[model samples]
Target: MKAKKSLVALAVLGTLSGASYAQSSVTLYGIVDAGLLYTSNVKTAEGGKALLQLASGNLNGSRWGLLGSEDLGGGLKAIFRLENGFNVNNGTLGQGNRLFGRQAYVGLASNTYGTFTMGRQYNALQDYVATLQLVSALTQFSTHPYDNDDLNNTYRTDNTVKYATPKLAGFQAEALYGFSNSTNFANNRAYSLGANYSNGSFNLGAGYARSQSPGAIGGAIVGNPSSATPSNPLLDAARVDQWGVAGTYVLGSLTLGLLYSGSLYTNSTFTLAAPRGTIHFQNYEGSVRYQVSPTLMLVLGETYTTVHQSGESGHYLQTSAGADYYLSKRTDLYLNAFYQKASSNLQANIDGAGGAASGSSQAVVVAGIRHKF
Candidate 1:
């Protein structure tokens, strides 16, 4: 009888140990960055002037996140991530003051299949095309004029359901839909699709997104409209359509990239002080990164944008250069600069770093350090 009881007890303990091993796994991760910045041509109702101040997120945004996974047997797992973006200077939330503004998602993953998630999340365009832009390589300061096409991740979609396919033969695809969740059903709907192909050192991607009345309450787009220098003006439009394509090639320690995107805002409320009208913008950019040594890197890029209104047109030209010295795998120091010139009635602006420019040109310089944990 004692021998039989011992066998049963051993089996129970083995099962409990297996369950614990499969269900208990969590991680904490974060990045912190701080810097000093100089800006020329900050425009206000009063006037424009050059200014210098301490800044955060010069090379990368400051953020902290928690992620966890549970193995559910049968090659499937449950996963979740909660990420928060914050300003290092004042210790405030970054995305419209939301605690987990950067990302908050719960999903399931399968080794043979792909992953599916739901919650506030990034659209397909940002995941596929915008991430390949050279402007992103140079940092937020080099973002395309106004970041009109969402390349700089100005906002995220709420009430979203997203699916990403497993990479097969160097190809992967993603789709997302955000619900308006209103009585009208489609009052503020948003959706996007994107695909990418990679082989060896070359990658190409494209994506498209559309939204209607996005500025409505609890909508897909999120930003502070009252701010003098809003990041993206089309967020308040009656309708918005955007698409982009990007490619990058790597050779040894050198990399080159090219990107193009266009955005159309129909019946937009904000058009550089215009009351209402249709506005369109096209942006093209090229960028290169070279490793000077195992610890040092260099980057350069340029972007040109063309804008069209009912009876007016404008243009923007921007140049960026930057360098980074790696102190370790998780820490780095950097210097970066950007100069932009606007034509016609378009005002120069670098969101978060500088205000709208009263004149036709704006320039900014930044130096910073970043650490990851």
Candidate 2:
């Protein structure tokens, strides 16, 4: 039986190689997820609206791509991947009309030294936020007070290089650096490090990242309005720094996860403006999940965030619950709800940034289906 299986595998490889026989073994795989969504008091910059919404893959953004690896011999392999994300409803590039935009990179993989690559990429914090959450890492739901930076961001850094280590006793680490690719004032660089370990029901992870004079929105706290208008401490840093630690434990049919994060800044400068004050933010998240059945789950989670805008500081709280059922290994259906309240100097929900509150809060409930192919 083993010999027969080997022969079958060889035949498939042979058929695939007919397209490019002498070079390498290459394969392609990807996922596409989509769903219809609704928001209660949808906050838009113009105003708030309540209506039926058809959101594309809020849980797992619909994506497709190609991955290939060529044997370079000498225990080294040339590897490349071009993944593109798209909006299912309108059939448009999901991330800013970028061809092979989601992840476009080429690098080398080695058995002994690990692997290194370069291109548009995510920082350490962006990758680990999912493992630390049990709501299946819902982008529109589980993010609560703040979504995972990477999932929500369409474009981060342009040029970059990354290295990931081979696993060590169920432990692995990665490091990344990004360059802005500019002529004058081109010292812009961002760096990050991440590490994780998993053993049985217990899993843990930690990560740190620093952005040197990055773009303001993704950069340090540039706050609202540019730096020139009086000094709003929130806009004090051109350099942004972030660090996080998160863990999960599975006990019987229940799983518990917790995460903590902090952000710091150095000099917040703006384009065509002077300088503002500094800003720092601290966030904490906790969640619990119970397996009600083989294909059903019950979850409850909360997030607390405190934003320190120079001397003045404010805080907010968010609570959420959601569930997912696997109709099959590659398809899922889900429903979720969120209730959020704020007591802060800043006014913003997950959707819009500025609003006048009755010290009022908002809520959302959504049901969606996701299929991966």
Candidate 3:
């Protein structure tokens, strides 16, 4: 009788363990991308020079992440994700050498309600409008001049709380707030809102974001590095505002896309030698994608950007093209090229190519492979 009782207890424990395991799950995923890049013009102290080098994260940033979910019953679940970005070329961490720089968030999700998460995460423009822009989806070098609108996701917000609404009638919305986490509550704070509507083959999205005293604190929406001078041009701004709208439509084997975005910075200093003033940028983009076959796709995009600062204005015109071929569901090869021209004493600087051009025009080409697991 004693033996039988022990066996029954062990069976009960096993049953409980199995049930618990069924209610929780964790997944590991990653992407690795590398490329051979060539630039027609890169500025030097003396003159422009052509460059050829190996680069990483051409189509997508190389990253790995862990995602977990626990079913808590009553149509609610606990979810968490930790994502890290790295440079495959030199095996160094990206995003200022911080671990899990891409995203680190945990919160509750409900089927009827929505999701609430807290941690380092992207803002509204990256979540909504960026998805609708073909350039953002295709390659990093295609972003609007210096990624002024954050559509290319140049930065993520830290100490952030985000809420996303459940899809209702083909519409979804989200909002986020990033606290400064300092004695001064308003310093380095940020907020954003985004919404999207998807109906059949057509989609539209809009988003807005703002930050106060960006780069004021290490844990703020835009963190400051240990170095005395910041690397990014917009880091030392007193205030930053960004807004955008985008739309996409699928017609047979072709898809059409359009995007418009604006960024404004107040009391910002670009460099140690530069003066503090207000700077504004406006971007307009259009793109088209054609599916040649089940595994081959072609894309073309163009952008016009205007900048105004200190009673002077400049403009940039950029054109980009790409072809992608899928070797398998998890692997692909791509060739992309870009050309940019600047006016009014502005220097052409294609995103992710390297430095600014010595002249008013620059061009770049990249061939790459991407794999996902």
Candidate-wise lDDT, in order:
0.85, 0.66, 0.88
TM-score of 1: 0.92
Expressed as tens digits, the lDDT of each residue in 1-373 for candidate 3 is 9999999999899779969674887899999999999998799987999999999999999999999998998889999999999999999998868799899999999999999999999898899999889665578899888888988877888899999999999999999999989889999899999999999999999999999988786545653544542435675688999999999999999999999999988877763112557889899999999999999999999999998887778899999999999999999999999999999478898987988888899999999999999
Cα error of candidate 3 at position 109, Å? 0.4
* lDDT of model 1 at position 210: 91
- Compare the candidates by lDDT and give the number of the best one: 3
Q: Model 1, stretches more than 4 Å misplaced?
A: 1-23, 223-231, 273-275
RMSD (Å) of each candidate, 1 decimal: 5.4, 6.2, 4.6
Clashing pairs in 3: none
Lowest summed lDDT window (length 10), candidate 3: 222-231
- Each model's backbone clash number: 0, 7, 0
- lDDT tens digits by residue: candidate 1, 72-138: 8888999999999999999998877889988999999887789999988988889989778875566
Worst 10 residues of 1 by lDDT: 222-231
Q: How much is the lDDT of residue 135 in candidate 3?
A: 67
* Candidate 2 residue lDDT tens string, 279-316: 56677889888888988877888988776554666676
TM-score of every candidate: 0.92, 0.80, 0.93
